[model samples]
Target: MPEEFRTTRRAFVGALAATTALVSSPFVRTAAANETFKIGILTDLTGSFSDLGGPGTGVAAEIAMQEIGGQVLGRKVELLIADHQHKANVGLALAREWIERRDLKAFVDVMNSGIAIGVNKLVGDYKRLAFYSAAATDKISEDACNEYGIHWNTDTYAQTNAVAASMIGQGLDSWFFIVADYEFGHAMQASMDQAVKKAGGKVVGAVRHPLQTLDFSSYVLQAQASGAKVIAIASGGNDTVNTIKQAQEFGVTRRGQKVVALLPYLSDIHAVGLKTMQGLRFIDAWYWGMDDKSKEFADRFYARFKKRPTAVQASVYSSTLQYLKAVEKLGTDDPGKIRQYFLNTTLNDAFLRNGRLLPNGRMTHDVYLVEVKTPEESKGEWDYEKVIATVPADKAFRPLSESACKLRA
Candidate 1:
């Protein structure tokens, strides 16, 4: 070979060898390679939980990306969202598509409890991560838990345990329950009933109403007729607010029984106004207007959506950020590894600090029992909930050893 030709050939061979090595590297050997870390946000955007789930959840995902600097590991992070419309089948379908087709590392911020449970099964079946952000059914962490999922927010057990025990301890004893007719309501009512009984309170009466009922007249009437000292509205968003409004209209509070609303959001309280919400006690994991951290986040959120953040929104943001962190740390979308990191890890961020994911999948953090402030006490439009007490995570939810999940026990 000619000298110049020999040198050129040597350089060309060296370049080709380098390229081949880069392509065959272990990090580049899998289907997950050449793809960004993808996460799915399956929530109710147009259903009963929309106000608490829709734009707010999107905001949370964005905040997570921003906090993580828009990348996990060396790959970019992408968030794909789907609306469940409060339907389990719909949510399950979307979850399957994201997991099987799009190769999402995890799904987050599922708002409906039924939808959460349904998706929990799908994630487990596929051995993928499900970072639950909003849905509060205890079953997600109890009978439904798997090695590949984590419920990163409050559950029925936590809410009921926090609100019921705290209220009962404060002397709100005899109870009348107005429950929504669904899994969420049933589980919550069961847990609340247990807490009330445990605290020496009696359940005087109970009635179930269809979800999203416009008028709670008859249900409120039943509660009133029970003559219970404490009337408990076990529902969320529109249902809880409507029941409270109807209870006020029916003169239930003025007559004797004080209505205690469970699982209320800032949006619901804002809708009912400070006057009606005054003195109404409820349980929450977070409030956007609580402090500088919350206020800063809420202000940024309102500036974008013209609405305040709810506990659900806060939950979504915290879970999304944590999931992204898991993806970065694991350096792969393997569900089993991600699951181990999530449940066995402690997540600290703007919303949740030193939060530990429980064996039953519950996020162990502080649960707040708050009372709605009167107009005189309120500071702003979204300044409704006044933190009455904080329930430690260990005591907020049912113990893991007591859970019915085979994966936990």
Candidate 2:
């Protein structure tokens, strides 16, 4: 070969060899392994439900991510948060985008039930995991549950059943409902109604109000006119706060009708003073001061958000941490494997104690029937709940035999 041709051929051969080696090397696998694992939080950041599980949920998830060292399987874990604005279509859009474009491994803290149900369907279709920390509708676990979704916090069925049954057992038999005219409110009212009936109580009257209604006087009047012993508020967030405040204004409690908030958050109590919220009974999945672990978590959370963590926010932390741990243990974020691991394992964490994941996608844990403390009884700013009774996990949630989920069926 000519000298110049020989040199050129040698250069070409060297370049080709380098390219072939690069293609066969572990760098490709390493790149794949190091790809970022992302978890998205689709929640209401600035809507009626914001105070309960909005930005606080993001903080909780971040706390969990940091607790897990912020990495998994040699991959950097990233969190993507978006406000669904309390709209199901908006939530679905954000969730679909995150799952498809960002390769989101999972979702946590989908706050509103309408939005949660929509996101649950999208997550199921994409075979991704969703840990619902705040969504209260029972349909997510009962009729709309997927193998990839888990209701990590309290649901309407659990809250209403526990609270209503407890009150009914105490001789407060007649009930009246002031419900928010939405999916969540409807579910809550329905569940409470069923619970009351099953507990040998009667629903004397029921009234529905629109979301974010500033006035609840009419509803309170209707409830009072019904002559029921217990007037239950089957709503949440700002609506719950407003209803309670208006009901108190209407002297509903003073008139001897007990006002019960079916789904009230710590923030709700804070929004409505302890005096107004005093003597109010409800069911909660977790309380900040429940144990040392919870207090520690709450302290850290309060440090960040300037508020104690609600049960929903705590569940966000718990579920997010557990999901990250499972990914670490399995060495992958495969939804099926993670689902099996979660279903087979009992979750005991700062937020959930002796929690078990049912086939219907409910994470069953003990729920507390708590009453708001009188202003004098409250020692400090977030010391509100006084646990009157503990409802066991098995009895707190709907039984699998009655589950509408095909997986359980």
Candidate 3:
């Protein structure tokens, strides 16, 4: 074995042993030979999305395990994680190995949209459960719905539709866009266009940046010349942060125009900081400061990690907890049984409550509109998003009837 793989295996085994020891004690339940529940966390641990998807998700799963007393029913849950490297092929390969060889009960948290879509198909073919919390493409649940997968959190359609419709109605009618070049980027752009048109706005022009383009000056320059009242960016995680910061530096906002990031979160805001991230608006699924439920969750997360949980982290925790719950209830690790249980049941977890699992594999949860707070007005670190609107679960996502899902049909 390669050195890194060997090290990763050793660490994974170590973690497994530690957790098992705790769970097998008097406080928690022990795993039955017939009921060892395994879950795989595939994420960009060393790539673009890692800033939001890395330590946060790993720790979040641990938090869920601890809260559940490290057990469920009469079984123990074991988590296995792999680094997807932001590559679709790598994600698919790892997913296949985990399902076929490692006996993973489910695959969760494939972060990049392209990778998420790729793994979604594999999950369907193998009849293994895939719970997606990080990928944002609506097509994962819409066009590509599967009996074995559930989209657990926000999608491109929800994020763009909510922000674009509101901004257009607010007199930000003319729009210019900087989009990443991929399925996710295209879906976001398309959703934004639909929303803008619905609200009587027009897209002046748009530019597409390559997937790995770090310098966004050229893209911002094109948007600057479009003369649109609002410059919109269709990207997320690090891409979103870099583009927003570059737009500010290039004075894209000073040219009688404002910049709007379609997706903003605690991780990106922390990276960009309040000074440069202020006055920008975006859509979010969960903000730690929003409500009593959210506050309680955030407090516990910070107590353990010394950092507030990002929406992605919270999504990981909820999805992990929900899957484990399903595994216990079904009394089997058969993928189809676990999947059916997940869809037919209501999920009331830490990050989401009364959230429904739609037939198209979409998990309908509350989404919010938020603006970044200015540095001087900020109270502390992670005080990034101030909720502007609360979109109810039903209104927050695309309807199932509109989804061209083969499974639903």
Write down the RMSD of all candidates, one decimal each. Answer: 12.1, 12.5, 5.3
User: How would you encode candidate 1's per-residue C-alpha lDDT over 46-119 as one tens digit per residue?
Assistant: 55666777646766677767788878777776666655556666667767766676677777667777877888
Which runs in model 3 stand beyond 4 Å of their true positions?
1-36
What's the ranking of the predictions by lDDT, best on top? 2, 3, 1
- Candidate 1: which stretches are off by over 4 Å? 1-34
Models 1 onward score TM values of 0.87, 0.90, 0.89
Q: Please give, for residues 147-180, the per-residue lDDT of candidate 3 as tens digits.
A: 8778988988899887877777788899998988
Q: Residue 31, candidate 2: how far off, in angstroms?
A: 16
Clashing pairs in 3: none
Q: What's model 2's TM-score?
A: 0.90
Better of 1 and 2 by TM-score: 2
Candidate 1 lands at a TM-score of: 0.87
Tell me the tens digit of each residue's lDDT in model 2 across 248-361.
Answer: 788887788898888899999999989888887888888999889999999998877778988889999999999999999998889999888888998888988889988889
**Per-prediction tally of clashes:** 0, 0, 0
- Per-residue lDDT for 211 in model 3? 74
